[model samples]
Target: MKYLMEFEPIIKKSSSLSPHTFSGLAGVCEYLAEPRSKEELAALFKTCHTNKIPFRILGNGCNLLVRSAVVPGVVVKLTNPAFCGFENLGNTVRMGAGASIFSAISFCSQNNMAGFETLIGIPGTIGGALLSNTSDKSGPISRFVRKIEVIDSLGIIQIRDKEEISFSDKGNDLRDPVILSVEFAFEIDKTESIVKRLRKAWISRKIQLPLGVPYAGKIFKNPRGLTAASLMEQGGFQKTKVGGAEICDRDSNYIVIHPNAVVEDVLRLIEQVKQGIRERFNVDLELEITIW
Candidate 1:
């Protein structure tokens, strides 16, 4: 409670988190801090560290699902212009962690830079994408990452190169509490070619995934050598529903939330799906979305 006064200028008490996420289903967090600059963020981090208070970073919230219970500690969101900057550096681009993935892809496409087309339709910020190693058929975003600036739990900043970080389908190895910025290397290409490819990728995603739906992206990661959606369909989970949450008719891998949905509805549906898949296919489905 004493620390609250230290950052009172940037902290909101007992704030609802539903509007921050794509699913629009979440409870409240004890403290929500929106620091206007890096210095303020570092100071806040240091305070939390010294006080032993738990904290988590929030991005675009496209792939997050928060529980209905009140979340204690701090939730940090980097929405200020200082943290959402974008810069073009010829063969490479420098992006603040708060920059949206759509903006990054569009910037690269307009500048005739290639390599980000594979993530055209994905939502969330650059930091969240990198943290989860977001990818499609082409590859993970880590492939283009040249380096990243991050703040460790101790509130110290460090630079990590591509070689220094390891990425996989599971996630990245960067244990830093905050990603400040990233430099991504890209190949030179014609603007028309890049835009054409981007358009194709976006259309393909819109067709396959559950677009324009009240869902929090994919609920489960594809098991090795198998797709989660196919497994769910095979398991007869298409009509499965728990409260106001139900398997998306467009894509069984996604759970659509109705107006009356609560976080418990989604959690229960996820558990049921996991249980059924485990029983039917003997495979343990891993979650892709972050549950807070």
Candidate 2:
């Protein structure tokens, strides 16, 4: 605990994590550190590693579902400009891990670069997207990734090529504790064409997703050839509700929260849907969101 004092300017003890996540329903964390630079991040990581303290990297928290129980760990948020910068190259763009997916897409569109339009409506930072292999029907973000810079659990920096990484529907194989930056290769296209594609993607997502709702993310991943939303509808979970959490009428795979919703409400609803689907269709649903 005394080590935290060394970085007092960046450390907040027993901080509420609700505002950091999209769900806005989390409890407090033992320590929330917002390191301003890579050096500070490395030092903080080293301190946590040496002290055997649990360390977690938080991005935009778009797909995170933290419980109401106090989370015991050092939650590192890369919000400083030093960790959220963007560099434009000729055909490739290097973006800091902390940069939002929307920011990256905007930069690409401005530079007349194509490919990122597929992720138009997706939230979260580039680091989280890469770690989760965030994608839709078009393709995964991994397809454009050329290299990644990361900080391992021991606070050592390393650069990994695309060949060294493997991505699946579950996520990526990179076990690094922190992603520092990502280099992406894109095609040169007209700015109008790129914007048009982005618009189309955004509209498509808006129609399918439960936007403008208090939700962490999609509750479950599509089970192979079958979509989770259709299955939930078929299982008659559209009208299901627990406390202030209910299955979104627009999309059954999402559990939207009301103003008074608690984490337990969402948890119970998830369990109910999982159990119902298992009993009716004999299919085990896997969660797409990360629960902390």
Candidate 3:
């Protein structure tokens, strides 16, 4: 419903490709995905199985950089309306995994929910955040998760409580469960203070991330006791470029997508950057963005 008014314009702006980055993304996904309830999701998966058709799940694509190469199967952008719902539960919030983290932070601030101020400018969905275990190793998104609802590959919906979910000290999730929704426990504080903190986070993000570019935020994850951005700068990989992909001079933490940059070009640059860093510092860089 709302997607018709909001995402269709974006769909039109982005041209379709044969085998794009996502296994099921861009033209193929945009044309086929129709968000529904759990039952509908199951039915859709059933249809895919019965027809011997292929399909895959995709979220906001914020953490994704799809290749120009395409995936043959049907693309599933989990836009299930139910997956976008946000509910207040005492000191917690139950949200659809599809709900944008940025939006969630704003809502929490408006409602005076604290503990999420640090996430104010982060652009991702609840599910993506959890899978990435977004954090600086002190804690992860799974740390705040009280429960997770997910649809397995079998198309069955299940919920995992906090105790059922566990994380590595390095901030990685052991489970490969496909998250459907999540219940986030939060601290309560004064609305004004939280809002102020949010503003501060936003300002910080604006300075660090290249907001106007088409690039995905972070290209590589920070290694133990080291920052990815810092490493890149040390080796002077900041000025490197592949096709139209370039390391943002303003912030080595981000890669800026020049006008008409293809997916392969971005991937090439990422590899080059990784190699450069390793050659100079002897550290293997881990990629942060999920290549679809």
**Worst-scoring 10-residue span by lDDT in model 2:** 209-218
What digit string (tens of lDDT, one per residue) describes model 3 on residues 1-292?
Answer: 2323432422222235333332122333333454566666666665555566655566666667766345444455556567777899887899888888877877788788876777766667778777777763235666677888876666677777778656643345535335778898887889888878767877877777646556555678778888888888988888688887788887786777777666676778888888888788999988778765
lDDT of 2 by residue, 173-264 (tens): 89988999999999899988987888898898899775777775767888888989999998888858899898887788777888988989
Q: Each prediction's Cα RMSD?
A: 1.5, 1.5, 5.6
Residue runs of model 1 more than 4 Å from their true location after superposition = none
Clashing residue pairs in all predictions, respectively, total 0, 0, 7
Q: Rate the local accuracy (lDDT) of all candidates.
A: 0.87, 0.87, 0.67
Model 1 scores a C-alpha lDDT of 0.87
Which is better, 1 or 3, measured by lDDT?
A: 1
Question: How far does residue 76 in candidate 3 sit from its true spot (Å)?
Answer: 1.7
- Which pairs in model 3 have colliding backbones? 19-69, 19-70, 20-69, 20-70, 21-66, 21-67, 21-292
Off by over 4 Å in 2: none
Q: In candidate 1, residue 70 scores what lDDT?
A: 84
Estimated TM-score for each candidate: 0.95, 0.95, 0.83
Candidate 3's displacement at residue 63, Å, is 1.0
